[model samples]
Target: MSDRTFTLDDLRRILLESAGAEEGVDLYADISDTGFEELGYESLALLEAGGRIEREFGVSLDDVNLSDITTPRALVEAVNELLSVDTAAA
Candidate 1:
């Protein structure tokens, strides 16, 4: 992978693939956008998914900051932010 930009659809695809959801499952909307306690995803889904994104993109996330990750867009932004730091350092 070339560390290309990620979208909500991309994160949703990863979530669907990891969570074993079918094509009809609206993970990004129904899951990621849901409140952390309400969806039970903040515990690991977003964090692990974030780690995967970082690994796939050759970057690293500030994993400790996942407490506020309530949406795929947030995840994307976090990954992008981390990647930006990585770019700056490189």
Candidate 2:
């Protein structure tokens, strides 16, 4: 896999443009880390977060399990595939 880099800002843009969301709603708000955990962000919050992720990564979250995303990194990897991330691999 080729080393790729993308900023959180890129994600924010996609979230707003594609998912029609604002940064005001943050799932990783109080969490120290972004990962899937019952103790962490709730499913709804996770879904919302996933929406931003899918938008940012240009991926589809329809069939993907909610639990599949436990962290930002995992989310990126999974989404990269759907997005056809050439800068990075999923």
lDDT of each: 0.63, 0.54
RMSD of 2: 6.2
Residue pairs of candidate 2 with colliding backbone atoms: 34-71, 35-70, 35-71, 36-70
Instruction: Please tell me which predicted candidate would have the highest TM-score against the true structure.
Output: 1
Tens-place lDDT digits, model 2, residues 11-77: 4444345445333456435332444452334567667767776554455688778676666556555
lDDT value for model 1: 0.63
Write model 1 residue lDDT over 1-90, tens digit each, in one string: 234676767776666555544444445565545554454454566666766776677776655477766656567777777766666776
Worst 10 residues of 2 by lDDT: 31-40
Q: How close is candidate 2 to the true structure, as a TM-score?
A: 0.47
Q: Cα deviation of 72 in candidate 2 (Å)? A: 1.3
Model 2 error, position 80 (Å) = 0.7
